[model samples]
Target chain A: MPQHPPPRPGDERTPGRAYSARFHLLDRQIVTEDGTPLAKADDLELIPDSDGSLVVSAVLIGPTALAPRLRGRPARLLNALARRLTTGPTDHHARIAMGHIIRIGAALTATTPPVDATLHPLEDWIRDNVIAPLPGSGHAPG
Target chain B: MRLADLMGARVIDVTGRDIGHVSDVRLTEAAAPSRRLPGLHVAGIVIATRRRSRLLAYDHRPVDAPWPLTALARRATRHALWAPWTAVTAHRRPPRTGEPGTVTLDQTAASLTPLRDMHAHWNSGT
Candidate 1:
């Protein structure tokens, strides 16, 4: 590969704070405006632009994004379970639009509000059918 | 396509020769927004000589640690190649039988930027 020097401090078009996607963004915890932890940014959605380049369209969060990154039988099991539970073969990932990103630091903060945890089918399933019915499960800790 | 789909995909030249694996992606900061959503543009993809199964960001910035930790990271990312998105062709999925996915490059390896030099250039300004 041909070697090219990195951009200097005063170089035009260089970001004020340069960030490598992996170093700065990937797998970061995504929090909402109210500081509620939503999810980790499991994957990125890149949309192709007319100029033959790509732009980060959104940050993907959820099991749909995580299963693919996992290897072996565990991945297979998760894939099977997710497929069986979904309404249909939908885009399983929950996307947080790039526009909602307010800041990027130790953790990412977005304008989007925290999703209701009850909306998670698996969590709902476990709560309604499994946990709620058990004895002494209704009350909170002292 | 999702970043997961591209990460670890095989990079090939016009002649269909194996180049390397997609190691990481590079993004340029989007212009400051005014009542708009902030975003980033994909500038390039980093290709490594080997498939880096583990995720590490040691390659992008310089490290000055106690000892071998820095040395090991430098060696790990020694042969990284930065391929600009402009040189990228179509992102073809279900790449012909043997390939998982293919990152088709418009030009040869000569067009890629070496990682070490990029780090030097980045540090020079600081």
Candidate 2:
């Protein structure tokens, strides 16, 4: 784990410098360094600082992290599915550490490719079983 | 906890007087481990005086707009204030006995920086 930086002197907000997580990061799409879509920032993982403030540790990307934001029936179904699929303590939402993030403009760009099998089980399953078998699916759009 | 959990949480001062509901969290970019990259840290919580009047773009960022819209938005969200995280001393979970939970601040709520002033400070680089 990377060492946490101490709090800055004076106010945290610096004009022309500070970025608001709610306005800039929340609900933004996560993309690879080369711009391939990976996932959305479903939620943020926070670890309590020794000083009592909460520090954002990672960007959470998965239905397990997103279930709280889903509406009534969808929330129930997703929660049930998540519970059924998650097998052990190791099964957790994929988290991209802040250190890996390259930029945070309209979309968040990460220096590293997303870990395979971390957050996109459904997408992987569909591609492998459904789409990959289709005759034209192997080629990119001309 | 999630940002959603904090957004609408009730806020109370050290004296146990109700302040308001948390309308939004005030965040600032933390020093990124690398040059030119951005990381975020929570700076404070924005308290909205009335539950219904949820302040939006007015409190955190400067909104340069057509005169009428700017005036209306500023007037509407005037009661919002940004209380520094230092004032936040504790968080309470919902009571097993059925009372609503609240976030506790160390000082009186009236001393918080008003949103208008925070916006000015945000823009002025102070």
Candidate 3:
């Protein structure tokens, strides 16, 4: 058997490198260019290539993408609840297209906006209804 | 399809013998058209005979870490196998209620490369 040298930490960021999806991609935090946290990469969208090999298409975020990974009764309930909360006819997880990704390091950086309505509908609702009603909520604290 | 759907799918050989379950997916940056970030192509699937928690990458990577822990991980994944993506003849079936999906391989389990030997192949950059 041939022996190979150990890979240095952070080597996965190197272009054209081979990486294990579980270790390098899944569960990694994703952020926008200005350093605002978006969401963790809960699941990956894989599309078949012309040769029938799978290529990563996008990073899938939110509960709809995560529930299947949890895999059980709780997962089923969570999936059902997420479906009900979703507003559109096509109920699907929020995805950040691979084309938008700028870099993959400790966190994946993308050109996507900080806040997306589809990404966090519940959070948006709470801010608009509950938080907006509070006195002095309009201004950011210094 | 989602990568989550294939994560825990059972691997079956051409003769219908159980091999193992997919432990992790291996990807390589390969050139492809119509992509901004370099395309991550599916390279292979890591299959382990026993249903253990994450391999922690000790099976393939050279991690001489905090002594005993590294030794334990190496022992745990001794029987793991590496099946190239080309060997996979079928994608996973839609998961059933409380059951995992299945991935069928055209080759037999014995013909697959051992996980321990994968590092060399990966380093060769083939």
Q: Quick one: best TM-score, which candidate?
A: 3
Candidate 2 residue lDDT tens string, B71-96 = 87788668887888888888764432
lDDT string, candidate 1, B31-76, tens digits: 6452132357777788886765332676666676867977876787
Q: Where does model 1 sit among the CAPRI classes?
A: acceptable
Stronger candidate by DockQ (1 vs 2): 1
TM-score of 1: 0.79
Residue A125 in candidate 2, Cα distance off native in Å: 3.2
Provide i-RMS per model in Å. Answer: 4.7, 5.9, 3.1
User: TM-score of each candidate?
Assistant: 0.79, 0.75, 0.85
- What docking grade does candidate 2 earn? acceptable
- Residues A9-80, candidate 1: write the lDDT tens digits: 342332344567776678888776566676788878888765566778888876766666555567557766
Considering only chain B, report the TM-score of model 3.
0.81
Chain B TM-score of candidate number 2: 0.81
- Candidate 1, overall lDDT? 0.68
Q: For residue B124, what is the lDDT in candidate 2?
A: 68
Q: Candidate 2 regions off by >4 Å?
A: A1-16, A69-78, A84-91, A129-142, B32-39, B92-101
Clashing pairs in 1: none
State the interface C-alpha RMSD of candidate 2.
5.9
Candidate 3 residue-wise lDDT, B8-113, digit = tens: 7889999999888888998877764533435887888999888655677664464457889867877866788999999999976546433567899999999998
